[model samples]
Target: MKLFKLNKTNLNEVEQIPFKLEKDIQSLVEVNVESVFNLKFIQSELSVDKYRIDTLCFDEENNSFVIIEYKKGKSYSVIDQGYTYLQLLLNNKSDFLLVLSQYFNKVLRMEDVDWSQSRIIFVSPSFNSYQKDSVNFKGLPFELWEIKRYSNDTVVLNEHRSNSKESIETLNPTSNSTISQVSKEVKVVDEDFHLSKTNQPLVDKWNELKEEISNLDDVEITPKNDYISLMLNGKTLCYLIFRKNSISLEMNRGNVKPDGSRSKNYFDLDDPKKISKEGSWEWKSGTKGTIYKIPINKTTDLEYLMFLIKQKYKNLSN
Candidate 1:
């Protein structure tokens, strides 16, 4: 895509700056993975078995490992390489856990990770039609991100979303058994999956909340394993956990006043630790600061919830 600079009424074309080496792209992405993807960087050039992963990252929200590969050439096959890395991860779960334990300076058990949410990400300047089409399946656990740099010292990374709705399992059998095995274990989840967990009334409330939150500037609604995250500029504004009868809203406890007093106009905050004891929801790993929960039901005031959400949005924006 072309970029331009507006000078008064005239548009001046900005030259594209090409990456000198694959490592250049890798370093840029590894350094800014958190702000760009909201993922935690574990290690670079992580070697497991005979394969070397370009970058290793963990999704704190989903408690899953993410494999990132940088490419400067267009001849590589995304499907083959992506599944190969995923297969390696699935087979060597212990090695990944060890790495995670070392990085965080704590011991982590296998059951603590959600392996089904594991996936691979491919970053490059451009992807060939064949490479893009290979990941057209809805069930493929892979993401293609195109990164570009301009001479004006600006860089943009955008995800390539596939429009196809076909599932990879429906295709004819292939010779590679790794693809089949990995596909069986790793599943792709969407908004519908989370919405299906609740009743129609709760779903309607979720839609209403989704619409109102989405109306905020540059807000992104992303569905994870257990909740729908409302994010602004890569920082989570709130987590919406759809329950059978009520939608649980999780936000940072810092949203409260400096004097530790709850706002009279907002819903009462419940301690996340206390709620977790009741088996209401699991506290996600890598969550910093204190968190408070607010349950949204039919009797709950929608305007009050939006009011609290708007405050968080404004805080994150600033």
Candidate 2:
């Protein structure tokens, strides 16, 4: 550095002076995590009862959360801090969970969602190869940014990211597994149901619903010969088996009435009335509101869907 003026006699001292290391590395990571991911960071102090954290980010879209910590010194056994944040997060889940579903968008529930699968990233300029190689990072979504001051007024930032371990069950693009075979002994539900094919409004409706619900999980627009089912939040809210223009409207909050009659009961939109929970949706003003208004098989509910899916996973997992 220009600050260190020395002759050849002291040249070795320059290398031993300890590089100052770029300081803006942490800020850059914060910028990307916030502006890119749309996360909010709340500043805090090590309060009387609880320790303080440097930064936290909420992924509202995925109902996933992320905690970030900066290490100015060496990596310590305190690495367990990230895990603690996750447990503390689940403890105060309500504050962050509800913020996920856009109340600004709509009052969808996020209680069924688990936020730990979010992520944790550590930023340090000097994460030695030893430290990086020694950490067992399995099953954790994380990243490391090693920043260095290269030349005059220039900095080098390297981002090493780990793939998210989060997995999902798509329509077994490679398996012969029938739903029946998957949930063989799992108290199967919707066994007699028909899958809805193309032109089914449920397909479109489910697509629209995805944007409205936050922290929504395992959403699959399941279609068979004549039925369409949306699997979300460990629950199959309802299913449709018809090709109706009823859902032409984008936003409809009340229940579409039965008897081909129109009433604002709101119960008409959901069935297996026990699972006929309250969920509101909105489309465009000029679109048709003719969404599918039929009940699913009585047995197919939230808990049951998880049972079936988990069961299916076991076979595939093995």
Per-residue error (Å), model 2, residue 142:
3.1
Q: 191-257 in candidate 2: lDDT tens per residue?
A: 1233133334454544444344323444555432234445543334445544333321111233333
Over all chains combined, what TM-score does candidate 2 have? 0.38
Highest TM-score against the true fold, candidate: 1
How far residue 34's Cα lies from its native spot in candidate 1, in Å, is 2.2
* Cand. 1 TM to true fold: 0.82
Off by over 4 Å in 2: 1-28, 35-49, 95-109, 149-155, 161-318
- Each model's backbone clash number: 0, 20
Residues 62-100, candidate 1, lDDT per residue (tens digit)? 899999999999999999899899999999999999999
